[model samples]
Target: MKSFFHVIPVSHVIPANAGILMLVFLGLFCSSFGFATEPQAPRLLEVGVSDVFVPQGFDDNDNAQVVVEGIFPTTCYKLGPVKVDINEDTIKITPQAYFYHGPCLQVMVPYKQEINLGILKAGTYKLNILPDCPENRHTLSIAHSTNSGPDDYLYAPIESARVVSKERPTVRLHGVFSNSCMSLDRVVTHSESNRVVAILPIAKYENNGACLDVLTPFHKDVQIKDPLKGRTLLHVRSLNGTAVNVIEDF
Candidate 1:
């Protein structure tokens, strides 16, 4: 009589390690495919008021020049006329930046332009970049020099504050700095339960010998634990151990 044998398929006799290897390969392939199919964030252009200057004793008709800067991710952008709005104490500008119809290559190009802000009194003025364009916007503080003497300096105050997140309890602040030599050191936040006691390290303007009195914008983000009930007070300090400024009842 002929001997009979049973045939086993190779798939049924696969080793444990082989199965695991196949699963890992599948997972990697799926991950790669997912990444390849994911949509990308649109490249954004950044516009800011780089510098502002006001001559001493300049009246409401003296033309002050403001240097505006733009950082572009692509070369297919055409900058339009910048709209300047002068309020009671604020100067708002909207840069008309838009993308033109063309092929764009990935490269960062920085460009700047000087704008004439019609005459105004010498005092603290806020420069806001209106969010009407498709690109990013920024606000700067124009601090008029004291003109008292060489030692006299003007400090940029905190203009506005808002809570960005509640889970991480992040606070966003907008301010201005006129001194170019000052560097932000750090921000400290003190909290008890839900009430915040203090945010240390206030922002201050110090004469570092090489400072140019040009009004510029500044921003800070502080992260803290979730507050229990009351508001938080925020402070800013410079690298030279100077208390710059603080915002209360934040």
Candidate 2:
């Protein structure tokens, strides 16, 4: 006679280990569901063009003049990195508007509470005091470029650069261009002062499509060349619009 035998599995018999098995399952479930914590990134504050302190920069390609308008918090507050937002219409200034124009405008806010933005472009912006700070101040300026015309076009690109070591020592420039119609008539540099220094052209009328020269950096007023006749190859505006340096034709 065949006798039926009963055999219990070891896993079933070891019921005490069920707790460990449940814990393992629980850990896996937690991991798969992303129960782990993570850190968040900091958000940057946004600023806008509140107003313009000055708006005298010349237009090159479009002969368009830009109006400086600074924008800030309606209430007093700190400041942060300036985010520049521009459109095609607001980007280029028209020649006619140069003579008769309103102030350019923008809005801005502090990314951090400790940041304090001093003077921005003045005539271009309008600000109201906030309860946070009763005394908020700023100024603004413009780096003028020459009026664009057929006779004076094709600005020379900056090919080389050098830093001055002397207190009042002079700096030199050298570069080549694809077109020969342009000349190196002058240069403008931005400095601590708020004036445009006119550096004399060392190499003028370089009809060979390239030129080079040197000029003294002793003047508080710094500007590369004639703004009305030529265009600026390099137009670098400072945090405050009032301070700017231009590399262009006079």
Candidate 3:
């Protein structure tokens, strides 16, 4: 190594202009490490969904919805507005989060968001979740309706739900109705299989008298006596054209 440095001719040495080259190198180095030296503002970034749950089926006039589940790296990350775009046969779903540049706790924050896909013609469609998501492409089938009109009962829109107990778990649901006339009719619990259960809280609307545009809250407690093992999904329907999916592992 000493012989290589010694081989350089004295006349080929860099002149005083080498100061400019050194400054440029230093600028590039600082730019690479600017975050350590300066404060950065919060950024709006997209997070990939871990899982997406779609309802059993949909009709042409029925409202379509899917529940999206994701996780944040830290507690500092807050969930932001979701941007969705549907073009013909494909629906693009982008779940966003707000990342604050400060002291962030090292924890995984799980999140669940519901997206209403609205009505679609009788055909097959694709649900495309944004970049680096698990199973980005999901097939959605919409069947043609032969019924005369829509169903009399609509599912109450649930805000949050949880399993109160593991053994003989009691599912607690809290939601709101659009008007005062709409009330909780009954809680229908259907066990598709051992692990999959669908709870439909049908809302009965009695528009016989004068009804006001009021938001009324409702609560329901569903007891599950059937034996369930492994992963269980409680797909609860919502009146606002959405579904709240609660996944429980026993």
Scored by lDDT, the top model is 3
lDDT of each: 0.52, 0.33, 0.78
Best by TM-score: 3
Task: Give the runs in model 3 whose Cα sits over 4 Å from its true position.
Answer: 1-41, 134-137, 145-160, 174-183, 191-196, 205-218, 224-227
Worst 10 residues of 3 by lDDT: 1-10
State the lDDT at 137 in candidate 3: 60
Q: Per-residue lDDT tens digits of candidate 2, residues 1-250?
A: 8769878798778788898999999989987986754533333443333222222332232221222223344333333333223232122111110111223233433221111233222223222222221222422233233543421333334444332322332344445433344445545443222322322222244445443454322212232332233222223222122222233223
Residue-wise C-alpha lDDT for candidate 1, range 1-250, written one tens digit per residue? 7669878988789875897899889889988887535544443343443332222222233344444455666777656567788887777776655565456777876655555675456665666664532222323334454454322222235565666765666777666666686545566566522322334434545677788977778887877654534333333322322222322233
Tens digits of lDDT, candidate 3, 1-250:
3554546765479866788999888888988988337777779998888776666556777777777777898998998878888788877888888899879899999988867777788888888888765444676778887674663356777887899988887899999877878888888887755656778888777996988888888788898767878767787877765667888886
Identify the runs in model 1 with alpha carbons over 4 angstroms from their true place: 1-61, 131-250
Among all windows of ten consecutive residues in candidate 1, which has the lowest summed lDDT?
50-59
lDDT of 2: 0.33
